[model samples]
Target: MAGWIWRTAIGLAAIIAAGVASAQTFPAKAVHIFVPYPPGGGVDVLTRTLADVVSKNWGQSIVVENRPGAGGVIASQAIATAAPDGYTLIMVASGHATNPFLYPKLPYDTFTDFSPISLLASSPNVLLVRSDSPFKTVADIITAAKTKPGGLSYGHAGNGTSTHLAGALLNSLARIDLNAIPYKGGAPAINDLLGGQIPMSFNNGPESVGQLQAGTVRALAVTTATRAPFLPNVPSMSETVPDYDTEVWWGLLGPGGMPADLVAKISGDFVAALNTDAVKERLGKLGAIPIGSAPAAFVAKIRADYDKWEPIIKAAGMKAE
Candidate 1:
């Protein structure tokens, strides 16, 4: 019995020591970050920006792969099934929390199959129209919609995306009936908005910033309760529709069962990158505010957001189609 106990203790110590050593030298090879959206969206841009900085610091190449489809489900499932090693990760947006409610069955559990690393940043979705459009303010759109029920149409990235939910929330809160037009992604929706195919669109900051800055598109209101600093002149939707608030956020996650120590190390590194002046400025230009919450806090946020949006999603009858 004494000999057996001694052997078990030694084996456990070796295992722990190996984990520590591995974490200390993590990312000896390239790290791949799977992005659910196609390249050039807010999530993709943020992930690439952080990857560039983090890769430099870690002395390892960080590759961002775009796996856009089914409203982020493709990349999410891929990450959920990836090895628990820290090399593989996924950059998720606000859609991650609401996907469970949108789809009847997911290939992997949102909370169980992945470990939350950090809540990187957030930005408001803006209600934009072409500069030549007749609508000048949030009231114009609502009044027009109220006057003609489903006549006025707005496009979003996809059903159940933050942009979609923002439009739905506006419809519900303001008692309007603007028809929602779903597109494959934000880019196409913006294209239609610019081409006069759609009168308006709920676009993320990164998607609309260039147009807004170039005087091609007009931002009537942002979805958040407060005006986005990047678009200070634009009003918040809440100013017209009471209590209205919707913002998209991004975060990093790895497959579940990653060593706690490694999780901490990665979270710390990413958080550090987010706090740097250069990163903050770059994200600011894109209308994203750096968050960088602790891993536990990020986990709590995912749970809270999931709970908060489930009823909204169900009430809206949102689904992946």
Candidate 2:
């Protein structure tokens, strides 16, 4: 009996030691990052940039795979089913938090099926109108909508997206009934807005910054609680509707059951990459603020955001289309 007990204890200790060694020597091979959006979008750009920085520091190849479809469900499903090792990861956006309320059934659990690594960055969604539009300010749009409930229409990247939710929040907080028009993506929505096909759109910073800088589209307000530094002149929606605030964020996640030590290492490394000068400059130019929070903090943020948006999405009857 004593011999049997000793052997079992030795085996258990060996397993734990092996896990610690594996975490210390993580990234034995190239790492693959799955991006839910296509290349050149804000998420893709941020993922690739971080990949480059982290790869250089770790001396390992980091690859980004674009799997854009079904509002990021495709990539998310892939990541949730991947091995819990630190090699496979996904770059998730704010849509991840609200997806549960939007879709009746998901292949994997949003909280249990994945491990939160770190929040990469966040950016404010801008409320924009064509330069030639008659509505000059947020008050003008609100007043117009009050005059004709559900008469004025606004476009968004898609239903249940952060952009869409921003517009919906506007309707709720401002007590207006502006009809929401969904587009396949932000680019198409911006195009239609430019063509006057839609009166206004809630676009992310990367989508609207170039046009806003060129004076092609007029930004009435940002969705964050405070004004976005990139557009200091524009007021925040909170200013008009007290306490109204919404912002889109991107983060990293791995499959559930990842070793805690491995999770900490990855989070620390990614956060370090985000703090680099070159990466900071690029993110600033992209109108994003880098936030490299701890894994637990990131998980808490996801839960908090999910709670905040679930009721809004449910009330609006938003669903995956």
Candidate 3:
């Protein structure tokens, strides 16, 4: 019995020691982080900024690859099937949570195929209209829509995107039927708004800032529980309609089945990078708030967001385009 107990203890110690060693020596080579959007978008820029800082600190190169297609599924599948090593990671946007509901068939399991590392940042989607438009606030839009249900229309980037979800949530919470016009992307949607083709738009901060600064568009409100720091003067939708909150968020993830020790180490490194002044300043200019949540917290966030949007997507019949 003593011999057997001793052998069992030795085996357990070996396993723990191996995990520790792997965590400590990780990234001996370059690491790759896949971005689901094309280069120059918010997700790509954010990923590259963080990767630059993290790679310097670790003395290893972090390569960012953009695999934009099918609303991030192609890139997501890359991470889902990659080896469980920490080297293979992905920077996913809010679509990561809602994709499962939007697409009937996905090559990878949304929740089980990848391990969430940390929620890096979140940005509000602004409710925008032309500077000279009659609608001045959320209440005005709601009243107008209620008076002539489905008479008013708003444009968004695409179906199942955070911007689209923002409009859908407003419609549900406010109990008004505003026509939702889907655009190929936010840029064209904003172009139409400026050209008087669309009355209003639900656009992210990065895309809206240029027009807002140019005095061509006015922000009615932001889609968040609280006012965005970048747009402090604008009210949050929640203030007008209780419990209305949605934002564009991005997070880091690796293939499932990663070692707990390695996961902790990688998450800690990214979180530390997110805390640095350099990262905070850069992201702030882009209208993003750094979160740097723990692994468990990130997991909870992903699941919560998934649950929150699933019913809304289903009821609206939103599908990937």
Candidate 4:
């Protein structure tokens, strides 16, 4: 019995020592961060910016690959099947949590197939109208929608996007009917809003900030529970509806079953990078608030969003387009 105990202790120590050594030498070569959307989008730009900083710090190449298709399902599937090593990573948007609800036949399980590493940043979707439009606040919109059900319409990027859900949440909470107009993307929706084709739009910060800055559009309220830091003057929807809160968020994830130590190391590196002045400044200019939350915190966020939006999406009958 004594001899057996000694042998088991020695084997356990060897396994732990090997894990530490592997984590220390992780990414011995180039690492890839798969972006689910096309190039030039917020997710792509944020991933590239962070990769640049982190790669320089580690003296390793971090390649960002865009695999856009099927409302991010294509890239998500890739990340789900990739090796569990730190070499394979993905920068996912808020849609990651909702995708499971939108696409019922996902190739991989949303919660189980991927490991949450960090919640990188969040940006509120702004509710906007032409600078000259009469609607000035959430109360105004709610009143109008209630006065004339199905009369007020708002444009969104697509059918099952954050922008779409923002508008949906407003409609539900305010108990008003606002005709939802789904556009191919936010750019076109913003154009329609400017052209008088649509009365208003729910647009992400990156796309709406420029218009707000240029004074071409007026922001009614942001889609967060609190006002966004980048748009401090704007109020949050919850301030009016009491519980209306939604925002565009991005995060990092690796394949499931990653060693806890390696997960810690990767999360530490990214969170450190997020804290740097240079990274903070750049992300600020893009209208994003860097979160750098812990893995457990990120996991909680994913679950929270998953639970929060499932019923909303189902009742609204939202699905991938």
Clashes of each: 0, 0, 0, 0
* Alpha carbon lDDT at 141, candidate 3: 94
The segments of candidate 4 whose C-alpha lies over 4 angstroms from its true place after superposition are: 1-15
lDDT of 3: 0.92
Relative to the true structure, how large is the alpha-carbon lDDT of every model?
A: 0.92, 0.92, 0.92, 0.92
lDDT of residue 83 for candidate 3: 90
Query: What would the TM-score be for candidate 4 when compared with the true structure?
Result: 0.95
Give the per-residue Cα lDDT of candidate 1 at 187: 85
Residue pairs with backbone overlap in model 4: none
The clash tally of candidate 2 reads 0
Which segments of model 1 are wrong by more than 4 Å? 1-15
TM-score per prediction, in order, is 0.93, 0.97, 0.95, 0.95
Q: Considering only N, C-alpha and C atoms within 3 Å, which residue pairs clash in candidate 2? A: none
Q: For candidate 1, lDDT tens digit of each residue in 11-108?
A: 99997887787789997999999998777878888999999999999999999999988888999999989998899999999889989988889999
Question: Candidate 4 on 165-231: residue-level lDDT in tens?
Answer: 9989988888888899999889999999999999999999989888988999999999999989999
| TM-score for candidate 2, residues paired by index | 0.97
**Model 4: how far is 138 from its true place, Å?**
1.6
Clashes of 4: 0
Cα misplacement distance, residue 225 of candidate 2 (Å): 0.3
